[model samples]
Target: MSQETAEPGIEASAKTAEIEALKDTFRNVPGLAGAPMIMAPALAETFATHQHELGVRVHPDLAVKKFIAPFRGPRDAFNPSGDYGAIDTPATPIPVLPNMREYTPHELEVIVGQLRDMGVVNDPEPPRDVAHVVTD
Candidate 1:
């Protein structure tokens, strides 16, 4: 006996339409002129989680070169001064952090405290007292 497969529901069709609309939006962004229309399979889930938490989505197929310069010049890899120094050397690749959620609350607190001690404040306090302006 032959069996017929079920068609996609209304919800699925709506989601597909939304995704297509998003893809069209990404294609039209100024700086992202040539970014891919679809996210990579490996990054799909991670990016979806990011969108869920941050309410923003990044194009997965965006080229790294667009954001970072290629390393092929006489400038020092650690620090560059001018346009020639804009490129980053392979010796000092950008650092990627692991998921912070994996850390225990105590571990996160310790990390934040250490960073704060080292002069890294997430939210700096604003000046309280404002001097009154005198009109001549």
Candidate 2:
């Protein structure tokens, strides 16, 4: 005898449809260009968490180059002006942090704290090391 698999319930179907509709709405929204279409709340949280973590992991040199170099004025004492100073700055080659494994317990706690403040995570405890979560 052959058995048939159970179909999804009405609620499940409705939820899926709602998620799809939300995705479509997000796609048409302005100023959200190139943003990933994440349908699940858990997935979005994970993505945001990772993004913030990576932001914290950015090398100091690269951060300076990208965020500071553009607005930097000329190095002259008077009314010096130009991109010359920015261009003359030596590039520091630093190895990028690959993952959370490189972060210390304190670092993880700080990241978790920031995430909590931004409402990305609701954990009441602080994160300890890479694996441990801080408890009150």
Model 1: per-residue Cα lDDT over 1-136, one tens digit each: 9987556797577555545434433321233554323334335444444454554534546524222322444332222221212223234443466898999999999999988888886657898998999999
Residue pair clashes in candidate 2: 105-129, 126-134
- Model 2 CA deviation exceeding 4 Å by range: 1-98, 124-136
What local distance difference test score does each model get?
0.47, 0.46
List, residue by residue over 1-136, the lDDT tens digit for candidate 2. 9987556797577545545433332221222564333234455345444554454222334433221122244322222122222434764333354599889999999999999999999966785667767999
Alpha-carbon lDDT of model 1: 0.47
Regions more than 4 Å wrong, model 1: 1-92, 122-136
* CA RMSD per model (angstroms): 15.1, 22.3
TM-score of each: 0.25, 0.22
Q: Name the best candidate (by TM-score).
A: 1
